[model samples]
Target chain A: MISAVSAPDPDVYLMLRVRDGDEDCFGVLLDKHRNSLVHFLYRMVQDQPVSEELAQEVFLRIYRSRASYEPTARFTTWMFRIATHLALNWLRDQKNARSEERLDEQWEVADRKPSVEQRMVYQARLQEIRDAIASLPDKQRAAVLMHKYQEMEYSQIALVLESSESAVKSLLFRAYETLRARLAHMVTGGTR
Target chain B: MNCPLLSEQTSDVLLDYSAGRLDAARATTLQKHVLVCDACSAFLAGQAEVWAALDTWKAPPVSISFNRRLWQKLRFRIWKSAVPVAAAALIIMIGFVYDHKSQKSQMEIDQVERTLDDIQLLRQFDVARAL
Candidate 1:
């Protein structure tokens, strides 16, 4: 039950309408969250096509489960919960799969940079960051992505990860600590 | 104001400060403490750099056909589900037609039998008349 003090979430209202057979509401929810959801999955899997497929699966699952959806938490929390599960499962399945990002794709995006030298440096640094993040333990990766990128509250992340808030915090700290060690060179003046 | 780095809970305070989630009052307190606490200040600076580096990795824009692809998949799933029901209905109709045809054939055989019996009775009556 929603506490009396908390204002009703607009997404939850939209979801409830979806529960009541409002197809338009589902579209609205999808339009609002599709990019973030896909981005989260993309970061998790480190593969765009796989992430896109997983995102579609996530929405498909949501659409499938609309009949039974309850306003138990924020719509995004629930959505990410499902997304995290799918991403984790995919990662587990592809445990031995290469974790490399397609550099050409990054180059395409990096083309917006002013000079070839600047683009090359940016690409190299971006690759390092991606590798550092991809090197984290799967759970830690999920936690950090949710905390850092999604800007999800620790409690919401816990709900998504099905762990306690403290555990989530610990996961994030460890993940960041690993990242800091790996990417310390990026810090200003090269030493933190 | 004990050093936030000394314990797990306090370390999280450091994280909150870096993330800007700390309240203004606590933020001021931490900021003042950081001026003298090299450990906390270094931790915050490192975290700041990490945050900045992370910000550079923007997510790729979502595909334009994402919704269309999803709707197509949904439509296919619906049709996939309907295929079995349609097959079942077809099977039931075939069974009913077969049963009805079998019943009609039985009635035709019964009519044929009655006609042969009538022929036999008349032949017997004609033989009786000849005797």
Candidate 2:
């Protein structure tokens, strides 16, 4: 169990150790942040394998830039900034490549026992939410994911996205409004 | 669907409220206002559901070999990057050594030239005295 009395930011300390030639500290940092980073990339790009690849690239970048790592911000902020930049570039590349080849690979669904009808409904709803999120503009999508999944503060989201707190708030507001318009039926049982 | 009681700024306020970013005093005030404003209340409710549905969405766990694979790639990249740096340093070191040797030889050549000049001047004086 983690203690409530917050210790000094372990990620920063570990990063400093990494800067000082501790290869093991890099492993520790990767283990600590791998899930969150991968999940963020997965949500950003909507592709699991690509997410994994990009997450590895993000870590590689961190290792490469370790010599210049400064504790000016929370380690996660700097880390996510790198992840966001990579994910956005990947998205842009996908966009450019879309004209040449359609990336319509089917994602693997989770294995669970349910009535076929029930599974169909669940999968349909899940797809709807995923499509809605994927439809958001890149920056707004990033802001929403960082805020919702990461439980990051508006300030932290700003830091990751390189925007002001007010701008982050604005992005969240607009993103949620669009989501609300699309998914409100799920809540209110109203017609779309 | 703008409510009469809420203005455009209310959207920002409502988002902040739902995100738990509003302070206690403002949150309490918004809570009181939300009770009376059905449209804003419904909007807030929908946003809450969006949050809930998003929370339900989880990524599959990374493979167990993720760490091992990442470390391997990272090590390879570090070494690959070091090669160029090492080569550049080697080049710079060689350049510095060559420059130092050239400077020393140039100084020695100048000293020899000065010595020859001195020898020529002395020989001239001796020749003049003999004449």
Candidate 3:
């Protein structure tokens, strides 16, 4: 039996209220997780609009499954589990739809009128970093995003990815190695 | 403690160590190894730089209407899901009312039949007295 002194997760408490037919609780949850969820999905899909749509779907799914929700783990774990599943599926579908469109599109930099040389160099380095990350395998990219952006632990990442802790670690290690190699010149403040 | 040299398999230990995930005993062991190993030390430094750089790649802020649009969608979904439940409840309530009305009518019919039978018996007794 669990100890009473160990309080439940605040999100879990809200979710329980949601399960009991309190729609307001769902709004609270959505407000809390929307940014993080969208950001996570944005990193995963690299498309802001698509990420927002997918994040909306994630909330819809959570609400739909509210009645059957169990506090088996942290609410964020379950939430990300759904988000990751949706993102992977979306990525897979996107991959099949257009195989040649895998390159990262040029993101529009802010409209600051810096020196031409400085701007070009900055854009190139930023694009290089984005491209390097975009080139990672799907699982590796997901693992890295969860670790780096979400700041999730390996165990939590494994739960979300449906993999083992060691597997999550291995994925992150490989992912960082790739990033390190590609961005080594940047780290050393040298032009590639 | 015998410090094991870092290998391909143990390379992840550097990552875990850099991320501050190792337990005290294991962290002490890896720290000892790093102190003697230049390669491992460099690896940790490179990884730390990579992590810092990755931190700069922030996602753009979501649109201002994100919450409003999401709330709209959620409300629609809730309304959509409620339709079936409402219809089912209506059907159940209608069936219950129909069953209740039928039972009440059956009881009323039985009462009428008993009153008719008593009238018939009274007429027969009055005819016998006349005879």
Candidate 4:
């Protein structure tokens, strides 16, 4: 089976190709990393459609910055560095545009619950987790996504965030602490 | 045993410990600290369970059309930016050819000057012969 051309280490080759006006390689890279990047952005933005659109923008940024690609760091680290910057900037712009943000209008998950009662319970618990995640400070939310979800080591995270490993750890600790406080009641009851 | 007020340091190390990154000696020290501190012990255990639950924190499935629409938008943007670059290259190529044509004309002009000078010399020789 001819699987999609796999991109392992030294994606510098792809970057170089992209520098030489090779948009195909960029497309391949985008397709390869889209799902994971989308998920990461989803965690950051807490909005599905917005995350998808934002992720495409991330790749476009990468494409434009092809001329400036240096192979000093792993491609993954470089990509997240850009992603985090974009997400943070997005948060800042949102805050500037609106004095205070509106609550997220969550789209319902279908067939995830068995009966009407189960559906209501599932939706409530889901909403609680969503709120807990949203209530976390932007940096902590980003740190949590990058560490817990992305499975990046602390050093890689430090590179992405331009912070020390200790700082990332502290951020994650605070984020986890916040989650514990907010969701402790719902953990067992799965209710409001 | 005197424990430092900075338990957060140990907590970070404990996270690394959970990830199996701590050296044997350091791990032993941290292991001892957790054993003595009930709060740290519970926190680590609680985080581990939360992490396990979070393993399922995946986003909902996106529509197939989502990828198509997103990539199309990206392509349109890139296409817009690329048009100018292509036009610039075309202009550069045209300029190079134009400069080459002018250089060839300048060489022909120099050759024509030498031909005219030779003809003048021949006419002077004919005039002298007539004298």
User: Chain A TM-score of model 1 versus the true structure?
Assistant: 0.90
Clashing pairs in 2: none
Per-residue lDDT of model 3, residues B12-120, tens digit only? 6787777777789999988887898888887888888787667656677887899898889878987997999999999999999999999999999999999999999
Which of the CAPRI classes, incorrect, acceptable, medium or high, describes model 3?
Answer: acceptable
Clashing pairs in 4: none
Error of 2 at A122 (Å): 1.2
Candidate 1: how many backbone clashes?
A: 0
Local accuracy of candidate 4 as per-residue lDDT tens digits, B21-89: 678999898888888887667776766655644553557565467667766877798799899999999
lDDT of 2 by residue, B99-118 (tens): 99999999999999999999
* Tens-digit per-residue lDDT, A24-105, candidate 1: 9989988999999999999999998899999999999998898998787788888898999999999999989986566556
**What is the docking quality class of candidate 1?**
medium
Model 1 Cα shift for residue B99 (angstroms): 1.1
At residue A173, candidate 4 shows an lDDT of: 74
> Tens digits of per-residue lDDT for model 2 on A51-102?
8999998998888888988777788888999999999999988964422211
Chain A TM per prediction:
0.90, 0.85, 0.84, 0.81
Flag the better candidate by DockQ, 1 or 3: 1
